[model samples]
Target: MHVARHKWRSSKTAQRGVEELNAQVARHEGRVQIVNPEGLHPLATRPTLREYISQLWARRFFITADARAKALRTTRDYRLWQLWLVLNPLFDVALYGFLFGMLLKTSRGIENFIGFLFIGIIFMSMMTGLMNSGISLMQSSRSMIRAFQFPRASIPFSTTLRSMIDNVLPAIVALLAAFLFQWGTWPSWTLILVVPLFILIHIFGCGLMLITARLTAQIPEAKTILGLVSRGLFFLSGVMFSIDRFAEHSAVHQVMSANPCYIFLTAVRDASIYRTAPSLATWGELVAWSVGAFVLGFIFFWRAEDKYVRLV
Candidate 1:
């Protein structure tokens, strides 16, 4: 019994000594960081925001190549290839024109109804496409995310970049069509604003991609949630008809006006169709939405950077 007591006291003394040593070594915490000096074990922790941003920038080339490959893969399977970009929007115009313009007569008092519909459908495609791009990436990219030792944020960023590449031609076509049809101010300088608007939409899409990518990774059902949200935004954004259909003081008018999607579409329509300079208020709202979404989404995604592989 005396020998056992001596051993137990020795064990307690050794443990206290080890704890003191560890506390001394750990400057910020009362713990120990075990470094495998033999280089057999590599230790990595979630990077600081500054380090995360740096890592993302360093991998920009990889992201670009991935985006390029994705963009090419999408069209490679289709016989019409890139022509589908222009054709798809035209087809939507025809279909929606028949459904809403003729059947529902939603375009009754709206001037240049074709142009209005064209601008709404073509421009709003970015929002819907980015949404799908964001949500679907979580499932489709599981293999790449698991096999690679990369920043998972790269996946969504590349998806957003891919979207921007696919959108360029369609955007140019929309602008030209609206101008030629005299749907917007034909000789207006405000059309130049579409360039900035395009970039703004890209940034906003990146934000959405980051946000939804993380959400869908953590929760498989977020895809369905995002779909419902997309359909809701579609109706609220006034894509097929004017929000003026709602009374000025009604709930929809208030909500649509405040909605980021609606605000973005309104700004683009002004630049693309009306030939009028977007009001400062419009620019302000656009800037706020685009920048705010991107910054917040990136941070949100970054917070769970270490868990992506396991979550998906």
Candidate 2:
């Protein structure tokens, strides 16, 4: 019994010594110079906002690429059209032909409603796709949230990028269909600038994605509410009909004017059908919204990132 007591005391003493050594090392760390090329590991306890951002930027590409590729493969398989590059938009155009052309009969004056609806539906769907997929981003990637320690901001970005790829086929089909139908002549050569315009739209989509991802990640119930909101936005954004015809209604005009969806859709419509640039005022609003969305969402989401693994 005496020998056991001695061994236990010795073990306790060693443990106490180790604790003291650790405390001393922690104190000395304040003066010690680190030659770390890869930087120190971030503590979950107190992460500076800037340091968190730096870590995100550092791993942005890999996370973005992996997430994007995963989303694309999933979409491709679900659609079951390996040649989805050709089929997706063609299908959209046909569906619109039936809905808007035959059912609504709203394309009367527009030589070929098929072409007009094709352009509008395809472009409008891009925004809808972003909005739709974005709301589900966090929920869809719950496993990734637990498995990886990268930035949550990358999640929305990857989702938006994936949606943009899906938009490509529809965009191409719209252009070709427009030309074949002569619904609107091929846009001005200046329309080539539309590429960057769509890019801005994508950035805006990213911001919306972040906003939605953060909200839905926290409250899964929000997913259904957002779906309803997106459906309303779909009609409001002039997907099926032109908002220009509603100019006489002051209230509707005002609401449409303030809608970011309207601004973006008009920007795309002007570039493709009217061959003009997005209005400066609308561009300014979009830029402001995009930057604000990203910054706000990043900070909000980052706060919960460490807890995500635990929650999942």
Candidate 3:
């Protein structure tokens, strides 16, 4: 009987010890437990804003490489190659010139109407391309997004970069056409301003792209709505004729004068075609629109980075 009681007591103590160990484990507050090997890791969590920016900076080379590759691929099918870049803008200018300059006689008040039309068409194309890139940025990049672990913002950045590079040849061709046809004079010192002006326009475009990218990602239907809205903006932008023609109507004049598109195009024409410095007001408006949009769009997009993978 004594031997049996001793063995039972020993077994009870062992059971009590096991319970205490479990209680200790349950009560433990700061211990680092091993995660399951197959479970999601902490690295999968969303990064901070500063970290996101750093990642984007680190991937700048990827942006450039991707932009170049896409640009080449886009033109590879065309036999004319880069000639299309020059010809497309020229054809657009001719069409608008005939419609607005000939049919409507809208060139009466404007000097060098062809040059004016050229500047407007080329710049508008750049703007429209940038915005479209942003709107379609996510949809087009789904495969990359799913296959890679890079900054999603890079997609839109690369898209904008590609658009800028593509526009370079078109811009050169348009300028040459302006000078060759006596639509505008030869280049001058004022033309140096084109660099800074284009940079500002690009910055403004980046902001717009960010905003549209985020919106389209959330609501795919927004793309169609934005397309219609952009069409309306084209008319308001004075791409075919001078907005100043409506100056007699004070309200219409004020609206068009205040338009960001009109402001940018006018500035370009002033520098490139007229060989004159853009007004202080034009500079101010451009800076205001570009900087404001960039700041707002960047913050808005950055806040939603984590949601993109899931949303897409």
Candidate 4:
């Protein structure tokens, strides 16, 4: 009985020793706190809320934040001067409406010339801003490119976004006027697609701008050439006419349909003008363009990134 009791006590002591060693190991590894401020064991701490939010903002927030800051600052300037952002577009609308819709009576049987002008003008303004910002990005951001290491592509993106925000007032006014005048009753559901479509357009625009900015930054004449091209694109884009009006003529319709900008504009117009979803081909083309442009622009811009500072 004495030998049996000795063996049992030895086994128990061994088990306890093993467990104690494990606890010491864990403390040394910092898995468990060994010392506290009062010379006692401590508890683990977690990240603070501000640190968590800062980490979240650091990732993927640059694109939206930088763009938004630019927009807000620009708008504040105009607002401080008591000049509304929509004033210019509104003035242009009034002048054009009087000359084309009234003086020349060009609208003819069109019930709401003002609404028509607003839509067309807003579309043109958005496109122009997108294209111009993209083209001028490198030139305008020479110092920024030289000094900073953030994504160079984000500059034009932010510029386009800034312009898009600036035009929000015009978009709202345009839609409101159309609804009030009963120009073309666009279903709210159809208009919901505008957000994604605009995103695609913005992506493509940024990519195109990156390529053009690099090209123009190298060759000054590229600017004039691009301006001329933009002018031609405007006329060919069918800002003033509905695609349906040209449907009777196959050749003209086909030519117009082939132009990417025209197709995109028509897709938007279809939703707004006819209150219907666009064809599969329209969605496919926009996706294809977005993917293709982004890939090509990235490759092209990456190659030229090393040269930006030298040129600037």
State the C-alpha lDDT per candidate: 0.83, 0.71, 0.83, 0.68
Off by over 4 Å in 1: 1-44, 183-185
Superposition error at 151 for model 1 (Å): 1.3
lDDT tens readout by residue for model 2, 1-312 = 999999999999999999999998888745566587787675433257898778778987876686666654644555565577667778877876788767887676664456667777777777767777767667777887767667666767667767777676667778677667764376686567668767777776666677677677678788899899888887787666767677799898889878887776667666666667767786788777667766776676677766655544
lDDT of 1 by residue, 1-312 (tens): 999999999999999999998887776655657877888753335789999999999999999998898784566679888778788888988999899999999988887788788878887888878877788676787898778777778888888888888888888777777666773346468778988998998898788888888898888888898999888887678888888888766886787778888787778888767767888988888899999999999999999988877787
Name every residue pair that clashes in candidate 1.
184-273
Q: What is the per-residue lDDT of model 4 for residues 1-312, given as tens digits with 9 covering 90 to 100?
A: 999999999999999999999998777844554565676542322234454335434644676777777774555655453256656777877776777667866576554556666777676667666776656568788787777754555666567667667667767776676566764464668887766777777667767776777778788678888888877777666655454567799998888778777766766655664567887878999889877886687567656655666665
Query: lDDT by residue for model 3 over 1-312, one digit each (tens)?
Result: 999999999999999999999999889899687878887775445678899899999999999998888773556579997677677888999998999899999888787788888888888878776777777678777787777787788888888788777777877776776666663357889888988888888888888889999999998899998897777777789888887778799999998888887888888888987889998878988999999988898888888887777768
Q: Tell me how candidate 1 scores on lDDT.
A: 0.83
| Shift in Å, residue 188, candidate 3 | 2.4
lDDT of 3 at 9: 100
Using Cα atoms with residue i matched to residue i, what is each candidate's TM-score against the true structure? 0.83, 0.76, 0.83, 0.70
Q: Weakest 10 consecutive residues, lDDT, candidate 2?
A: 70-79
Residue 84 miss distance in model 4 (angstroms)? 2.6
Q: Weakest 10 consecutive residues, lDDT, candidate 3?
A: 176-185
